[model samples]
Target: LAEKSNSVVDNDSKRKIKDKGCIPGLPIDGLPVYTGKEVAEHQDPDKSVWIIFKAGVYDVTDFIQIHPGGRELLLGAGNSVEPFWKVYSQHHNQQVYRILESYRIGNLREEDRLKEDRTQDEMESLEFIPERDPLLLVHHEKPFNAETPANLLIQNYHTPNNIFFVRNHLSVPKVEEEDYSLEIEGIGLDRTYEFTLEEIKTLFPKHTVTSVIQCGGNRRNDLNKVEMVKGISWQLGAIGNTRWTGARLVDVLRYCNADLEHPEIKHVQFEGLDLDAKSEPYGASVSSVKAFDPLAEFLLAYEMNDEELPADHGYPIRLIAPGIVGARNVKWLAKIILADHESQSHWQQNDYKSFPSNKKQASPEEFAQAHAIQEMPIQSAICLPEDDQIVQIKWKRIDDQTKPFLDVAGYAWSGGGRSVIRVDVSIDGGKTWFDTELEQETPTKRSTTTFSWTLWKSEIPLDFNQLRNTGNQIEVICRAIDSSYNMQPARNEEIWNFRGLLNNSWHRINIKVV
Candidate 1:
């Protein structure tokens, strides 16, 4: 049989050999070299499904049925799998290689291989807009995270979209208006309800809420000074106030027949359309009580400050969990689940949690026991005269009196619907204090439901004699009192954590009195 197989083969024999498998010795190194166009033709799963990994092509039609991640996730079926594999790193292991080796058909053409390699590199490169405002201080460029300068934050009552602090975990996904849809599911519902962009607008009554969204690590830089901590060194600019217009989350849940009162529903998990390298969606969760409370003012916002939601700020839809940490306000919203447990996303379980101040080096067990930060504590920061800034003071000697004054300004806010009742400022570093005029743009001044931040300013009567004697350095300190009588701690050491989160200590800034 071996001798007979070695004989000169006819067209029928050659066809059989090719159909069964590769022959022992054949031209083109025992595998046919398919053109780039020919490889693209097999993209359809129903037909011949082919994918390229490295420089080799594989026919994965049979393997698609048994793919653990599902066949729909095989996005590179018609093209190179390098991009998908780069994100889903699990494929880079040896076990996956063994599985793929069985389906290997041929090597990709050299030109196509080089083109795909270049395309993969481009996809992995971090992308950011070059026209970003100069006022924004970039913390990271890959994910395009930045914060507004403290001085610019007080320029207006409502923060402009361009200068708003951006805290992104993944690339901003570009979603088409016509193709956008929101999915609702979980144990509290009988079935899933998919809502198109138009249906979301027409089916519910539009409601607007002027609220403040603050990152959990708003004043992390202050904490970092006391002790080195993990996370972006965000100053006081991580918070922003805006008017969000959309349907109430409670109304939407009820419209979808969600059993908000169901005993099994403890949390509402939100998934964003923005995907990570692993193809997993960015996600977070809020307590079911907060999500379902009509007074909580939660929103599925489509508009920001009367304008259509900008692409940087979640485009068509984003969740606004007022009075909660900004991380819970999931943007570019895609799916919502009424779950018994909190979201299993990395941001929910691992990050955004505060540990004990004494636990300098936290272990995995300690982090697991620590509760995630939801509602922030009393917080305030001086925005006008930034830290280490030199201010020019005007001194006048009129008649028989010498008078000097300085204008101080900043913002204060508290979580869980608490209003900042008063803000106290001291130029002598907490020795002497004076009250500042508090200004807020909320619906009711008496209402404790202060979802917006309070902007406070005061003109302090400075003692020229004392200022001249203080070696030209003045330490200014500010602390806030909430409606509940909660005040920021005197020092960061009191509230310091490994993650540098929720740093609401009395914000201090030293200025040179020039």
Candidate 2:
């Protein structure tokens, strides 16, 4: 068999292989080379198959069993780069190869590369058990915390109940809605007011507004290069725009006998249903100016996107404060307290606050001096056609057949009700710029805007032959100019911080031509 294989290979060198004629030794059958996009797509269980990866390293540790189809198929490849990778694409980065070295299966034998029947033991003990695919978002192949992508953000008025990004510190609690009661207390009041969900909803004027909620660390993933941060590697999707309708928090404060306009009060405290490892619940505090400002539009929302809040996004009742970091949108609303000082919950006192741009986990005393992450910074990201795609088109064909290989689109928003005044897109790494048309859907006030984050777009014209001729490389970047005309820094290094928060540099992507 060795002699036969040697002879076939030796013979093939004598003949030139054409695009269509190479069968047994065809690229797909021989070894696969995959782009990041292709790997993400094939990770789908129903459609995923064993493709021979090129002889190299591959990091499969994190992807092991979360595979919806199971792990055996991948484990079956053993350590050889042949059979499976024959269909998988090869990564080009040395860093990626270095990481993959930790998970290599083993070397392969030519004969073992042939297909074999599965044994009963191998078939029966499918330990994967067909449970839910643990990778919440298909692309990342990991649990959904904060790091999910922006474009992956569901495109409804409110994020779809199922896909709303989850940023849980502990497992979600299964509190019965009927048993739930909201407790409100003000430092000046003699007693706390406990109201059932029904009572709160019926008591206040039902108000609804579509607003975007983002985690303060929405772009923390981009900050890891400077120094390690201590929290979730949330991407832009930590934000979701939803129509929240329910009782105004102001009204609730009024019922608690709290003053509407007062100088003594400084902060409003909120507690969630989540508990720490020791069973202590989580809570946070926002300033009185942020919480009670008529324009802030805070709410004890019973409905998200016109429906009861789903369990993942704070079922039954959740505090919905538009234009603030999601950490303040405490899920499973439990308590609201008015005080001269901030809430004493661990989240308020420790976790959610931001350190000095120069500090790490500051001491408690140092933290006392630090400020909490209230509103998010100006930011944007491209959602469609993704980061890298090999698009085939003729420059002439581009006119009507295919939109320019490069179409820029994404969302942009600012903190403190600051509207995004302009958004710019550049296909050549910002060498040249073009202003994109903003899609304004509703009337935007200083606090509320018809455009939450202005979704902007632009197009580039390229002929197919040119794309194929150019080796298919193009860079796309986007930047937002807010009401203050403060543009995101072009590079991340200038704004690097210890907690990896607010790294909103111009987002860029590169794609190949096919």
Candidate 3:
């Protein structure tokens, strides 16, 4: 044999090693030690697929089809798997190790092994600030998902970029303005178009839309109270209203000669710059009808609240699909694909879906049957006097006797371009309700759509002596009515779902009167 060679295998030497006789798991006199360059040559799945795991080479060509995470997520088919496996720690188990052992082919040369070790060390040293707002409650760190507290969310009509709720699916990508480019492609387009930051800014007239972007799972904690549901246990602050300024998506589509009238085009997929370990970008799709609709009020926003978009909010650009669920208003937008089908991304296909209340577990069949959440339902929440809080009420003379009166303030919103016309507040758990004064920021004349949220406040009168005699605690509930006359459901149990999406139930809070 080759005298137990420890040196790296060149292209010609690797071919020679492959020709030499060897058996699986058997002791060979001169087992091949492949160089990193040699390993990269087998990346194409149609030819051969190789991956290095802890200095061990494995031919995972057949295993690709059986990989639980799917074949596309195999991560660098012919490169070291250490960096990716570090991000996806699920593969660190003994079961996955044994499975990899079955596909062992050879070992990485000592020189390449050392290089991979150094690369992994560099990757481990990278740090990301997964959070920005101290008041926002964090749900996950790596993906950097957080929600604003109800009290802080209603402090202003336009939520500040710093404290705005963030719902990222991956680490916030660092994008430089000079290097940024927005791509437009796919089957529905006559030709593809690429625009730099400056080109996009000057190419079209800047349009502004004041709108609300709400998470599909807003108020999910209420649903969780009725029954355990899967999702970030967002209390009530997963929604925000902001003024977004950018070029119209329709105008951009026209500039690119997109075949919007094409009958085959069903969805417009948006891909973000943020990527996962597999290098797959975060993506979601909106209906082409909405994308092309002149009155839909969609925008490719470069500015939020008249300021440049913050890094956490798609610094260079983002899709602002007003009146739609926030998930469809994709951030860090880099590519717009006019496709015949919806985006096959995990967020579009599996998550942000509404399931039947009876569905206890998330299954393939349930996911397949459920439709992705688009527009939200009528929703409102009490921001001040938090649940289980003690409120010192001021005494007021009512019928010549002392009675407690306090101001209750909160926000109310609806989806599908509907405005919140009325918000009813009840201090006795829906037994009696009083209408609150609704205030909405004036919409831009260009935007005929009503997409912004309304801040509602009401001063409630309480009988102090009657409450003191019965109990100190009282339940306060609020429900909203949309312009379409649609009202929030009376209870969470009635509208609970497996994914905890669209929980537009009456918001209730219990406060101790002092």
Against the hidden reference, what TM-scores do the models get? 0.76, 0.68, 0.77
- Badly placed stretches (over 4 Å) of model 2 are 1-135, 138-151, 154-157, 355-361, 393-405, 444-451, 462-470
Query: What would the per-residue lDDT of candidate 3 be over residues 324-439, giving only the tens digit for each residue?
Result: 99988888899999899999887787678876788655555556566888887888999988998998887778688876787789999888888888999997768789989988
- Model 2 C-alpha lDDT per residue in residues 1-514, reported as the tens digit of each score: 1111101222233232222121222232222233323333334333332223332223353444443223434543323333222112112122223333333222222333332213323423432221222434432211125334555553543555455566654445666768999998876566889999899889889988677777766766667656656455566667666678889988887777777566777888888876543456678888988888766788888887788777667767888877777778898888888889987765565556655567543555655566777777788776654666765532435336634545556777776667888888776667777877786446544534432556676666544565565667767678898887778889776676655667789877677755
lDDT of each: 0.79, 0.60, 0.79
Alpha carbon deviation, residue 434, candidate 2 (Å): 1.4
TM-score, candidate 1, is: 0.76
The superposed Cα distance between candidate 2 and the true structure at residue 107, in angstroms, equals 34
What would the per-residue lDDT of candidate 1 be over residues 1-514, giving only the tens digit for each residue? Answer: 1112112334554353344332211222344566567778887777678877666666788776666445544577777775555434334333356556556566578787778768766875644443467788887765666898999898888888889898877778878889999999997677999998888889999999888899897888888787777667888899898999998988888888887789999999999998976678989998998888888899999999999888778878999999999989999999999999999876787678887888754444555566988998888999978888899876667678877777889999898888899999999878899989988865564465868889999877788678789987888899999989998899999989867799999999999877
The numbered model that scores best in TM-score is 3
Candidate number that wins on TM-score, 1 or 2: 1
User: Over the full model, what C-alpha lDDT does candidate 1 score relative to the true structure?
Assistant: 0.79
Clashing pairs in 3: none
